[model samples]
Target: MSVNLNNKKESWYMFKIGLVIAFSAVLAACSGGNGTKNGEALLTYGNEAPTLTQNPKQLDLLIFGGTAGVGLETVKLALARGHKVTSVSRRPERMTLEHDNLNNVKGDFVKSESYASFIEDKDAIISAIGVDASSEKITIYSEGMKNVLKAIGSNSSTQVVTITGIGAGDSKGHGGFFYDRIVNPFLLKEDYADKTRQEAILRSSQSRWTIVRPGFLTDEISETRYRVLLDMDGVQSGDISRADVSHFLLAVVEQGAYINETVFLSN
Candidate 1:
C-alpha cells in the first residue's frame, strides 16, 4: 500500500484545518472569571472616566460593554475621528455623546435578540468588554463574540475590532521564562483562557477582524507613540494607556493593518 504525494499534502492541510476548528471550539468555551456573580455592575471605567473628544461622523458604531474606561475611550477616539457610535449594554444609561456622531442601544451579550438591532447595518464595532470583575455571570467572551460576529455577518458592511488581553493565546511573554511560567500563569490564567476562546471566535469568523491584545492596561497616557506586534510576534510591556489602545483600534481601521491577525500593543 502506498500514499500519493498529492494525497499526503491534502491530508496535511485537512489536519491543520481540523486543528484550527477544534481550537476554535475550545476558545468559545473559555469565558469564566472570579468576579461578583450578581450585581447591577461597576461601570466599565472605575475612576478613569472617558472624556469625550469631538465627534467623528454620524455613522453608526456599535461598541460592546464599556461606558467608561477603555470602551468609552474607544468611542471617544472614534468620534474624534468622525465616526458615529453606539454602545450596546443591558442597562441603558443617560450618557450623551459629546459629539454629534453618537447613539446608544440597550442590550446584553447573552441575548442574541438584543444584539440584532444594535448590529444591523452598522459601520464598525469596537468591543472593550473586559472579563475582569463581571466575568462569572456572563457567557464566555468568545461565545458572546460569536454572537456579535454572526450578527455582523448577516448585516451590512461592519468591520470589527475586539480587544483581548495579552497572554490570550501564545502572546504571553516576550519577557521569557519567568514571565511566562510565573507571572502569566499566576495572574492571567482565567482571563487568558477566555481571551483565547474569544480570539478563536473572531479568527474563525468571516468578518474583517482585528484582535487587539494589549499589555497591562493602565489609565496613564503617554507622550511617546506605542508599538504594535502581530502574527505570533512577542512583545513585552509594563503598561499601555487605555487612551492609546483606543487610538490604536481606530488607526488600524484606517490602515487596514493587523486584519485577521492578533496584534499585541505595548508601551
Candidate 2:
C-alpha cells in the first residue's frame, strides 16, 4: 500500500494542536483559576517569610499599636499580601495605608472594651506596643498586653505575636554592656519592667503565642535576611529594620513555626 503524504501531514498537524491545547490547560490549572487555587491566592513579591512552606495566607489580622513603628509595617505588609487587616489604635485616622482589605479602628489597647471586640474570630494578633525610652514609670506595655490576653482568653487556636525588646526576658544579657547594664537599667528601667511583666502574661497564656525580641530597631530599608536566635545565651544585641521585623512577624503567623516560644531577631 502506498502512503499518502498529504494525509500524513494533516495527521501530524492535528496532533500538534491537541498537544498545545493540553499544555495550556495544565498551565492554567497550576497558575490557579482567577488567581486562586486551593485557598492559595497569588502573592506579591512571593513569600516574604522564607521559612513558610507555602505562599503567604490572607488572614484576618488584628494589630495593636498600628500607627507607627513595626506595627505600621505589619499593617502594610499584611495588606500588601492580600490579608484582611484591622488595625486598632488610639488614632485610626493616622494610618495612611489605603487598601480595600485594610480596616482602621479607633481603640485603646489599655482598655479591653476598646479593642476587644476586634479580637473575636481573628486569625492572629500582632502587638507592637512600646513606650518611650525616657518614660519614668511605664504601665502601657504590661497593661495593654494584659487586656489583649484577657480578650483572647481560651482561644488556643488564635496565634499571637508580641514585640518586646532584647532586655525584656531571659535575653537580658544579650544586649551587651551598654544595653544590659546602662540603657536597660537607667534609660529603659521602667519600660523593661513592664515588658517583663508583659512577657510573663503571655507565657502563662494557653494561646499559641510567640514573643519576638528584636534588637535595636532602625528605620533603614528591609534586608529580609536576618538572624533569628531562639536562644539568647551567647547572643549579642544587634540592629534590625522595623520592616524586617514586621516581615518576620507575618511569617511567624503564616507558618505558625514558633508557637509558645520566644525568639530574638537581629541583623
Candidate 3:
C-alpha cells in the first residue's frame, strides 16, 4: 500500500485546527467567557467590561436612522427599558414602533439639525447609519456624522456612540481570515472608506464618544454573550446578531461606559 505523507500531515493539521476551535468554544462557555483575548475584560473604565451603573439612569436617547436595522432594534430596546427614545427617520410614517416614551422625527441622516435639534437635551446621541453603494462613492456616514458633529457642537453634554463595522480604522484587517482576504478588499472597500472617514470625524471631535465595530451582522436573537474586543491581536471576526449590537449600544449609554474607546463585538 502506498501512503501519501503530505496528505496525512495536511489532514492532521486541519483536524487539529477544528479541535482547537471546538475546545475554545467549550472553554469559553465553561469559563463564562472573558471579554478580551487573554481573559481580561475590554471596555474597562473603573470597572471590568461595561456594566450597568449601580443606579442606572433612565436615558434620553436620540437615535439617527432609527427606522431600520440596528437603529430600529436600539429604538425598540430603549422604549422597552423605559427610556425616552427619539427616532430620526427619513420617513417617520414608516416607523411602526410606538410608545408614550417614543418620539418619531422625520428627517434625512445627512441633515442632523432638521431632526436632532433635541440633541441638547439627550443623555446620549446614537448614530447608527450605513450605506449601500456600488457605483457612486458613499458619503452618508461621513456626511451624516459631519452634520451630527456640527449640531452637537462643543457644549452639548450628550455622549455619542456610533456604530461602524468590521472594516474600519485599526479594525481594517481584523475581520478574520476570509473577510480580510476577500470580502473587505473586494466588496466593501468603498463603504469602509467612508466609514473610516466617519471614524475620523468622531475622533477629531470634542464630544464624549465610543465607536462600536460589530462583526458580520446576523438576524439572530441576542445572547448577550458576545465577546468585546478592544485589541485586534488574536481577535477573529465572528457572527454577532444585530440585536446584540443594539444591546451594546444601549449599555454604553445607560451604564455610561466604553467612552472614548473603539470596541469590536463578536460571538
Question: On a 0 to 100 scale, what is the lDDT of residue 237 in model 3?
Answer: 64
Candidate 2 — which pairs collide? none
- The order by descending lDDT is 3, 2, 1
The C-alpha lDDT values of all candidates are: 0.63, 0.75, 0.77
Q: Across residues 106-220, which tens digit of lDDT does each residue of candidate 2 receive?
A: 9887999987667888889998866645434688888887778788888548898889887787877666554476556655677788888989988987778999888778798
Better of 2 and 3 by lDDT: 3
* Model 1: CA > 4 A from native: 1-59, 94-99, 133-138, 154-156, 174-184, 222-224, 231-234
Weakest ten-residue segment in model 2 by summed lDDT: 32-41
Q: What is the lDDT of candidate 3?
A: 0.77
Top-TM-score structure, candidate number: 3
* lDDT string, candidate 3, 1-267, tens digits: 999987887676556556545754664465422233433444341222344345466888899889888999999888878899988877788787869999898878787668756777789989886665332378888998888878877877789889998789988876655557655655567789889999998999888989999877879888777767777775556677889899888888987787899888876
Clashes of 2: 0
The TM-score that candidate 1 achieves is 0.69
TM-score (all chains, Cα) for each model: 0.69, 0.78, 0.78
Q: Residue by residue across 44-124, what tens digits does model 1's lDDT show?
A: 211222233354335567888747778888877676677767777665584445556677778777577987866778767
Tell me how far the alpha carbon of residue 163 in candidate 1 is from the true structure, in angstroms, after superposition: 0.5
